[model samples]
Target: EDALYQKLYASLKNRELATKDRTERNSMFARRYPSHAQEESKKQHDHFSLKAAQSDASVEASRLRRQQHFTELASIMKSSNESRINSASERARHHFATVQGEREGKWSNTRQRFDEIRSREQEQRDQIAEMRIIHSNELSFRGTKNSGSISPTSTLRAQTPGSISYFSNNDDETAKTGAVADRLISRILKAANSGKHRRPSEVGSVFESSNCVSSLNTSPSREKPREIDDNATDKTQI
Candidate 1:
């Protein structure tokens, strides 16, 4: 406040004395002397006013010099404060980025670990299930092999016992037919076996058996069908 008042006062005095010179002051003295002829009093007042204006000029010049220093100090302080603020902001941003990156990395690693653990666990479970199935199959196969409840041979016999007996009877009947056919072929054709037919019971039985070729009551050995046909053909040719 005091500085501002002094500056204002100096500005007013400078304006008043800005154009002051010997010629201008003499002109003012001439005009004022004709109006009021107190030469000594006017000269003393003019000298005092000149001295006051010089003092005011010196004070104003000193204040303006200090103003230059004040302006330079204010600019330096402003730049320092701005630089400090910028550096602080940069540090804050860097810290935040680092923290965020670390947090995200930790989360990523944790997720990967969990997934790997789960995959291993799932694989272990599958292996256990496969082992259980293999063990069951092995047990079942061993039981089937060792147990005699349902063997392949027994199953086959059980399924075809009647059919097997029937086939055997049919084979016996074919053999009996063949034997009678042979006897007939020899008798009708007078073959080399006439001595056998000389037995009446054998001759009668041969004729009877020939009529029952489909019968399955033959206890005699089987004869080949080809041999029977050959004998018949020989009788026909004869």
Candidate 2:
């Protein structure tokens, strides 16, 4: 019995030790599993943060590029506007110069025309003065010629061709008296033929008694009456 009891106690002690060892191993396995899981979670969080940072940097770069492009475009537009303005100014200057040249040309033409008109007026005035001088000279010459040839002595000389003197009777006076007597005789003959009964003695008495015959015969004894010849008398009567 002593031997059997000793064996039983040894068996009980060995079983207790085995149980303590198994408990220690289980505690160690639990601690190691929790530590590994914590490490994996930290790694995942770091990857997500890095991707977010990269995305932010890309967005900033795109914004900067857009701003630079806009700045360059504005500068180009300003340069184009300045060029257009300069071209317009140059055109305006050229137009003004053309207008000034035309005005000067017109002024020159007007001055030339005025000078020509003045010259023509002066020529006309000279011609009128010359004409007046010529007219005055002609009138003076005509007055002098008319005054020189109308004297009393010139008139008496112009009439001297027809004067005649009769002592018994000049040829012109005898011709005129004979013509009167012949005309009376022809009248008396015509009266006798017509049975009016006038005699030749009666006709002579009527002729001698005429007042016109007595006056013609009794003219101034110093100056005789002028008798016109037959041809000259016809011309004068005409």
Winning candidate number (lDDT): 2
Residue pairs with colliding backbones in model 1 are none
RMSD of 2: 34.9
Stretches of candidate 2 off by over 4 Å are: 1-49, 118-238
**For residues 77-105, could you state the per-residue lDDT of candidate 2 as single tens digits?**
98888899899889999999999999999
Per-model TM values vs. the true structure: 0.37, 0.33
Off by over 4 Å in 1: 1-37, 124-238
> Per-candidate RMSD vs. true structure?
28.5, 34.9
Task: Write candidate 1's Cα lDDT for 1-238 as tens digits.
Answer: 9999999999988877865765587678878686554676688899999999999999999999999899999999999999999999999999999999999999999999999999977766665555455434433322111211211111101123111111211223334434444444444334222212246676456646555333433333453122112222111110
lDDT of 1 at 77: 95
As a whole number from 0 to 100, the lDDT of residue 40 in candidate 1 is 63
- Cα displacement (Å) at residue 214, model 2: 48
